[model samples]
Target: MGGLLSILKGGAKEEEPIDIPLNFGAQPSGPEIEYYNAVAGLMRAAPGILNDLRSYSGCGEAIRQAISNPGKATEDAAWAVVCPAVAKLKDYYDFSCALGNAMGAHAGADQQAPVVSPTEQLFPRILSFLGNGDASQNFEQSQALARKLAEILDFATQFDNLKARSASQPAGQPATMSNPNVQNDFSYYRRTVSRMKMNNAQSVAVVSDEVANKMSLFFAHSNPVTKALIDSANVAVMSRTLSLGGATDVFSILAGVSYHMVAKGRAGNDSAFFLRVMVVSVLLYDHIDPAGAFIKNSKINIKASIKVIQSSGGSGADALLNALRFSTQHLNDETTPKAIKQMLAQ
Candidate 1:
């Protein structure tokens, strides 16, 4: 997280830290005006969108079918039943809030503007459309809509957490919930491998060899429990290492260990749930961080960092950072044009 902060800060040169009073009441600028316009467009369409939704065949049919249970009915309905309507509503609220911000700026009430508590927060001035309903009914509808949206947006895909758990266990050995101390298992190997290249682990082969040597040392010992633990960890690590050892393979085998572990159901069963959280933590780190650069004169190579991010589906922060890093490092590459760099920065 600190590394991410450094990278963000690195984009700008150091300057005196000046303490400026923040006036929440300050007026907004042209870009903010455009932002409000976009939001207003969406907001103004809310009532019509909701009306369309209410009359839509699917929504009407779903509602009728759900007569037995409104709660269950909401769960089964498509986004058409709620998304367009609620999204428009949310847009209206956002626009009103933004307008209030713009007004605040005009008043120079930036920091002094009163912060409304959740319960005390009044309905947006534009959402008078919802005022026709009884308070109890309106609240119910809002709650239902919120619940339905939550269901739609829930990223049911189980990737990071599972891999972390699988990695935690020693390679080749199936990790069980009963056995807590699994030694230097797959998880250990994953952490090791991720650290290896980032910190410049001598070579991929060397990292693997080290794991093997450590396993050998563990097995050669007298204690059965210790040997078994080490052996299990070795197996887990080896599986990931082999798959991720290739030059073009950017996916961190170590990171994927968690995914596999979660799939194996070992993640939730763990005593500490450390492995599960670690997987997410790694993702969070990768998400906001810029790909570290190794710039020497004109030569540029984003191969290492870019590959890692691309292998992970290319949506993470590392991917974006890597792109920026590549552009920054090679801005003056002999073959490239300055215009291209300017275009990319835009």
Candidate 2:
């Protein structure tokens, strides 16, 4: 009976099959090589992606350098592998390069690890005003900004979650990392990635100005620009939201007031100084509120403007006045308008 049973079992001992290690050194299969090729593509594309983002912000100097010297930008981009280094610690010389890389990676065709870009913020705000009456384009711009922001925030959240899990992981588990927390984070990342891709795939057509305004406020806080620019963008976004909420001409008046406040009244030598003043003026003028009296407060005009306009030296006050004068000529039309021209002529 034992011999018969052994014959029936065909010499099987009921032993479990041994697992073999995957050898990475062997020349990769087609699919494996393709995957590796994709990764290499990502590595090579990462830097140029960043440069494209930097260009979006209209940072003429940075763009100029990137265009003028590609080698330096490429090196700086490679150095930005570390998350924190990519996020914050960028040298002034290589700041644009780093910023470019982050933007590129965030807004790249492949949504791997999104990051916030100052350019993304500025682009929408600028586009809203300068869209040549193309609401579709404006909406598209807004949607793009939203998608990029979502991706970046998602990346940050996932990175943080992963780092926390990795830190808390028990030692000696090198073969497999199967922590629940890590799994959850991966799930979340997957969802976020899907959402971002969906956003990209869909037509980004914002129906309301509220979305634009929020984006403007976000950029105002993030980018390193003059205080006037921040304040102006905030006001612009606020004006747009208010207009959408039934405020009439509040933005228009605000624009004029903001324009005068910074262009002829403030100080700064920065190239963006004049542009920011002009932007605020345009934004405020577009959406002026009547019922609530959301006009420029007395204190902002008095304390801030007085301090800015009073400087005789070329630092804060003096530079601000110079910017104001330059902007006023263009905004207030010091040349064409007879009354303004006469007043200035006098």
Candidate 3:
């Protein structure tokens, strides 16, 4: 952990010694202290959590290989890889979720300015959303949904263009690309894709459109507390899309899937749980922009560091060690709170 802290600090000069008065009468006690302790605990546990994830990535790769080349691998072989991988993933997710939950509970228990129940509710919901098996499934579903939405968007654009041409044409003059056959084909495809469901005489767009609308709202809204959770979900969707051709690395795929589930809001009640976890986790650990760019950048750096460590033939233990080193090195490069850093040092 010390090594990791050093790495995150980025090789800065050591501070000069200074004489100061000591308050030895009594140690501080209050919600502030509880919050400090919680964040310190998270910092200490982060490397271990990362180590487990690195191991889980290996399992993810084995499962991927087995699935891709089924002719050479049996179903039993695939399950052998998948079952253990899923179990490890679950363990990591549960630990992180629990940490977030404990933090929120402590915060709410404070007598002064107690945290609202809804805010406290977010942690478990975010965890449940990201920790479950459905996350991967949701990523898969999102791909299909995205493609269909793209088609609908294209159709809408084309229809608007056609209408514009018709209106702009001179009287008694033929419009450009105004062939009846082409128009009919376009209408057919559009109607087929946009087919509606009728229940109680109320019409609902296809599932793809509904998902697209949700995604739009997620991106459009600006809620600082839920920003990390939302960004993680977006990353998950992009990562899954990239993995289709096996171009993306295994570690990225894992991170992306975890984020995607929470961001996509596909886990029903689980979504709320995971969002809360993310909000509380950041507020506890990161003092600089708890829900902003700092958290996003930290995630990016962690992923890059993991990739570097794995590429150099590092084992899970080595990865953890190196991650600690890297985190310590860069700690000084960012605006993470000084108090939080000092707490970690202790």
**Which residues of candidate 2, in runs, are more than 4 Å off?**
1-85, 89-241, 244-283, 286-308, 311-315, 325-346
lDDT-based ranking, best first? 3, 2, 1
Root-mean-square deviation of Cα positions for candidate 3 versus the true structure, in angstroms: 23.3
**lDDT for 62 (candidate 1):** 40
Worst lDDT run of 10 residues, candidate 2, spans: 15-24
> Worst 10-residue stretch by lDDT in candidate 3?
15-24
- For every candidate in turn, the CA RMSD to the true structure comes to 28.2, 30.2, 23.3
Tens digit per residue, CA lDDT, model 1, 125-170: 2122122223222222343321121111111011111111232443
Better model by lDDT, 2 or 3? 3
Candidate with the larger TM-score of 1 and 2: 2
Q: Please give me the total number of clashing residue pairs in predicted model 2.
A: 28
- Per-residue lDDT of candidate 2, residues 247-282 (tens digit): 112222222233343445332343233323323332
